[model samples]
Target: MTTSATRQQITGARSIVVKIGSSALTELTTGLDVRRLDALADAIEARMRAGSDVIVVSSGAIGAGIAPLGLKARPKDLATKQAAASVGQLALAHAWNTSFARYDRTVGQVLLTAHDVSLRAHHANAQRTLDRLRSLGAVAIVNENDTVATNEIRFGDNDRLAALVAHLAGADALVLLSDVDGLYDGDPRKGDATLIPEVGGPEDLDGVIAGSGGALGTGGMASKLSAARLAADAGLPVLLAAAADASAALTDASVGTAFAPRPQRLSARKFWVRHAAEATGRLILDDGAIRAVAGARHSLLAAGIVATKGRFYNGDVVDLADQKGQTRARGVVGYDAGEVAQMIGKSTGDLPADFRRPVVHADDLVAL
Candidate 1:
């Protein structure tokens, strides 16, 4: 079947975010492989021509840099890894541009760090940039800003980044291309392992064990599964498939382990708070707070919180955890850490008027 027709038949997802894994786009000892790049580009172009707005979150800058820098393997140190990404990003971008030129389509490069999606301002900037690119008929090629992003602020792996990007781009669907063909009940290398063709929800992933990534990739089956679930939870259908089956998976959602999405899509603020925003600190809430905040869907109050951990300011993302340090929900704080410390454990009726407002408003919070 034609790629466009197949995709439309699968779902009415007019916009899609396709993540190409590092191992799928490059050779072990060489940089980005031209054949792999062209093949994937061809698939993406077909969808775009079919009138679907397509965005690609590609992870190959480090892999592509390895060959050009004469490195025998992936770099281990942060500095060396950054250097490799610096070189590889240029090559990767150029290759993407050249490959898409085959279909007479233009490519726009968008490099993002965790802060870009976490901070309200930067996140909006990214949204506008990609939206503008789409309006101009340009396919956005997004990646984490590996060159300058530090471990402290980076989006650990491209899989998570892709999921966050999928939501940020307002994509209707998310397709993650990995080294493996599909998610399995166990290690695929084992004789008894069976491919899980469909995932209805989180319960299906209980006790599932998947292997880690190869030498050239950062994501593994576990990460892919997490990303798929994250996207699916936000009402975005997700497909996890082998990179070799890029065209098939991109077109035929049934070709991979398809994740069914929630019928009701989350609002933009809820999606960002639950997935993209990074927690700057932790809020230790009592048992009553946990139930009230997460269960009753009540706004988190200072009286419910027992203590605060870490330094954070007003409007920053903070985890609302229990005494055992288990996070139950996430929300945007209304006061700084210093201010919150003063009001911890104080009842609204007992506190002054200025300090009685919800510590974290209900609208700004999301249950995990």
Candidate 2:
């Protein structure tokens, strides 16, 4: 476990990522809640006015569109969900725009799918865009592109998305505004739960009965906990509190469960390679290959590879696994699956001029 941040330090973090869960933003029957939006916008505006840059990851599009689309409750099918998102995203953006207008602040909408952050080029583009948006003094309101994202490609919840965004934008801290006040040792609904004030590492989460959010929401305390750990691992602290306490939480008034960050900061390339890229295939490596790639952190030569499994392209991310079936590293394969298969067990010098290089370059590889 790392040393937790003091209240004063937590309150002073300048770049922050604020995530608002669906349940916090939308009503079950009435749809979009203007009052909640206004209150949230006000808090965010206050933070910005105080010279802090804020990035918002909001989840409420599908939830907000359910009533207007004449659906009884949250949609079940993918098509229905997409339709609702298409309709609701506009309303979500509009509500934010209107709310921010009251405080004379600007908001930028950034919709992303898993693919946006998975591919190297797309990831860089998104990062650059976010940097530019913040440089211009605009708060970015981020959401998943649910209209095109299937379950396989979606982030699963905004909690995880916010963690990734925090890293992407180089945020100093993350605030997860949930329906609950903070993480509890047991189920708070059971009336005997106790709020855990600080989490320095995984050990702090021991014996906590974490659970998902309401049916209308995609994330719950469990997801928020996972997100907090993820951000903490990347050297970004996390504050989990109720949406109603946004002002207090942002001001670092000790209102939420704060997860302290690791002392060492992760490099951007390594962070993206490890967490963002989607592995499309697995490459089995011999002991020597493991020692070279995993132990020494070297590029994967074709001769060290014992075999390859699954279809992957030249630029697709692949997992390098030991014969024992444990993934030791992940990297963008320099050669396609077929190309690597043909070169398996062949020494670099024995291969043709064009086929003599490493299967995955060192720059593209990150030890897991």
- Taken over the whole model, the C-alpha lDDT of each candidate is 0.88, 0.88
Output the lDDT of residue 70, model 2: 89
TM-scores, all models, native as reference: 0.95, 0.92
Candidate 1 residues 131-248, lDDT tens each? 9999999989999999999989998889999989888888888999878888888986867888877777778887789777789988888789888888889988887887788777
Task: Tell me each candidate's RMSD, in Å, in order.
Answer: 2.5, 2.5
Candidate 2: tens digits of C-alpha lDDT, residues 1-368:
22345445557878888999999899878899999988888888888888889999999999989989988888889999999999999999999988998777688999999999998788889999999999998889999999999988888889999999999989888899978998899998989999898887889888988887787888888888888888888888788899999888876547978888889878887788788878999999999999999889898998999999999998888999999999999988998899999999999999999998789888888887
- Using TM-score as the measure, the top candidate is 1
